[model samples]
Target: MEEVYGFEMSDGTGDFFGYTADHLFADIWTRPGLTDRDRRLLLIGMLAGQGAADVLGIQVPAAYANGELDDEALREIVIFVCHYAGWPQGARLNSIVEETIAKAARRAARAGESS
Candidate 1:
């Protein structure tokens, strides 16, 4: 959360951070019902449906980073989402996915160079 938002949750949010950490991240996210990949897929769908590009920008890349999604799978998801979420929403998500993939590749190349 700090890396994504640029500040710790305890940096003045009071109990808000505690609730997020204890409930949202620890309790809900750690539940045994769904795999991390399943959670990522569901979140992507929900965010795309609501036109939440800002959060999607973070999440889509995270999906890639966590191995929950690959390029082809992400493309397929965008195409599938187009039918229910409208073309514009799908297009925007497609753009985000492409950008995320490219950024991940750049990061990987840089990491390899430093090795």
Candidate 2:
């Protein structure tokens, strides 16, 4: 969860969190057939197609932070997904992707300056 979301989670919250940690993250995410990057892309496509901007917001930044996606690829995803997912959802995705890219650039700059 922390690896994908970029934040540490508390331990033993409840059944919901437990199932998420033990089953979703531990089992499903770790399956060997697909790489994390591949899963990320598939997840993004599904989220975009479903018009799930809120969740996509989290995944987009995490994907960028984890080096699974770059600015160009993210933008290209917007175009491709928009064609199939509808223009309105694509607009939402485009906004999220651009925002994520800008935030990532700012973060990198701050890290560079701290060095």
Candidate 3:
């Protein structure tokens, strides 16, 4: 984040970024024909092209928490992108997806057991 955006992202700075991110996203990414999940996946694709799988991977949960994604759907998106985006990119994203999925599944499992 500091490398790309030049901001030291503490909670205060991040709050400002969040506000701007929300407005900017509501304008462009949420344009006609795109849902928030679509916008998130699109952003992920673009970021992937720039070799930013770490951020992309981390954003998956945020997207889900923000009501932009579901796990099964994300699985398909990753596989579909793998076909069009090539093996190296696919391999990189695969690690991200696997890690994200495992984290989500673990969280879900823990919640279920506690319930």
Q: Candidate 3: misplaced stretches above 4 Å?
A: 1-10, 14-19, 29-33
Sort the predicted structures by lDDT, highest score first: 2, 1, 3
lDDT of each: 0.83, 0.91, 0.67
Q: Report clash pairs, candidate 2.
A: none
lDDT of 1 by residue, 1-115 (tens): 4333333456646687778776877777778999878888899999999999999888888777777789999999999989989999999999999998889799999999999
Q: TM-score of predicted model 1? A: 0.83
lDDT of 3 at 106: 92
Candidate No. with top TM-score: 2
TM-score of each: 0.83, 0.91, 0.67
Candidate 1: stretches off by over 4 Å: 1-12
Q: What residue runs in model 2 are displaced by over 4 Å at the alpha carbon?
A: 113-115
- Model 2 score (lDDT): 0.91
**Candidate number that wins on lDDT, 2 or 3:** 2
